[model samples]
Target: MDDASDKYRAPALEKGLDIIELLANHGEGLTQRELAKSLDRSPNEIYRMLSTLVRRGYVIRSASGDHYSLSLKMFSISQRHPPIGRVIEAALPRMRSLTRKAWQSCHMGMESNGDIVIVATAESPGNWGLALKTGTVVGLWNTGTGRVLAAFRTPEEIDDLIARHRRAVGEPEVVRAEFDGHLARIRTAGYEKMPSATAVGVTNLAFPVFNPSGQVVAVLSCPYLERVDDLVVPPIDEVVEIYRTLANELTALYGGTNPFEKDLTP
Candidate 1:
């Protein structure tokens, strides 16, 4: 820490923030003793902070009163931020239309600190569809959403994104040469269509959403599932076209150009 900047720190505020950050990573909740041990402090040092957090609705005390986890308050607060709020608001109606047309659930995600964070989603109006919830963090190398986000960036930016990436659990390691080639193909096609790395029997179709500068801002993806029984949906080819149109409409929300109309080679 910088001594000058740290000279007048509020220790209590630091403790409260620390407790909140710790709880965010532990979805199962943590006991007071567990929190203390993780922070290398005594339980008594954090008791008041934890109690305050629970009372204020930022953290939830378990039914047994022994564990603490974050409530939805932080997520609720984050969604109200203007930039993300605008993206979600604009994406939802389009996403709903996409689900209606394609009969598949779709999600919009953006790269944040080298991770793809699903920001908004629309569910299929059909009987069943796979959907990832908002706030889920997915890895860059193993997902169609991640590939589309990286495919439109400059080579240097792509390198830096990979370097800073923290892999999610069960995400496979990347081979730089092969992954580079994969991105090249996405750039060539202006999108990605591949079987999901983590699931069987589903193909993931992803397209880039860009800003006015032609820089990719987010990705719109559909986890495409084919029905084996009597239920029928649009064929994958038609669904891909419908999805690409949705992506273009979203990009237009930012005054972005259509990637299909330009040569994306860099």
Candidate 2:
């Protein structure tokens, strides 16, 4: 380790954070010994850290007193951030407008710990539109918005997210080259569209909201369903155009570039 790095290291804090991250990735609570093994540390080294975390309400200790899991504290704190509030403020009106015109329910989502979490939502004016409620989470490897979010992230981030995704979904390791190929195509397309991976008879149309730095800050997606009763619903092609225009306008307002303008290689 470098001299400067050695000069200021917070060993206790690092152990606490490691515990939080480990629990965040795993569904099952871990016993102290299990945590130690997973983190490659001796159980005695982490016992005090786990106790402090539980006392602070960041980690919950089971009644059996042998296992620990993350509490909702981090999720709660994230909701207090002002930028997320601003994004929701700017997006709600536009999303509501889309619902009226396209007659499809729409939601804004963003990646959170390798999953897409719905942040804002607008229901269709008509009675029969699909809606994914705010706070709902979808897997990184499963949904259209999730793919768009993944496609635009840096290569290293993509790999890390994929690793977490495998843990979250219980899938075998996905070959890196094949996954990268999909992301490259998605980056060129500027969006992702496919039948709903978890639902029947619906299509997911998703686009990214990028910031001025050309980084995606959030995702805008719609669960489109043809209303059999209306008989005048926008066709899928027109729906794509509407979402593209809306996404482009939103991206510009957020001061971000549409990467599709640079390439349509796919």
TM-score of each: 0.89, 0.68
Off by over 4 Å in 1: 1-17, 261-266
Model 2's TM-score against the true structure: 0.68
lDDT of 2 by residue, 1-266 (tens): 99999889998898999999899767579999999999999988889889899899999988888889988787777767776776777889988988888888899888766667788899999867788877666766667787788888888888787766633343334566766776776776778777887789999888888888888888888888876663698888787878777777888877677867545321
CA lDDT of each prediction against the hidden true structure = 0.87, 0.80
Query: In candidate 1, what are the lDDT values of residues 1-266, reduced to their tens digit?
Result: 89987998999999998999788789999999999999988888879888898899999988999999999999899789776787778889888977988999999888878878898888999878999988888878889999889888889999999988878768888788888988999988899999999999999999888888888888999999997887777999998888888888888887788757454321
Go through the candidates in order and give the clash count of each.
Answer: 0, 0
For model 1, give the 10-residue run with minimal summed lDDT: 257-266
- Between which residue pairs do clashes occur in model 2? none
Clashes of 1: 0
Which residues of candidate 2, in runs, are more than 4 Å off?
1-77, 165-178, 261-266
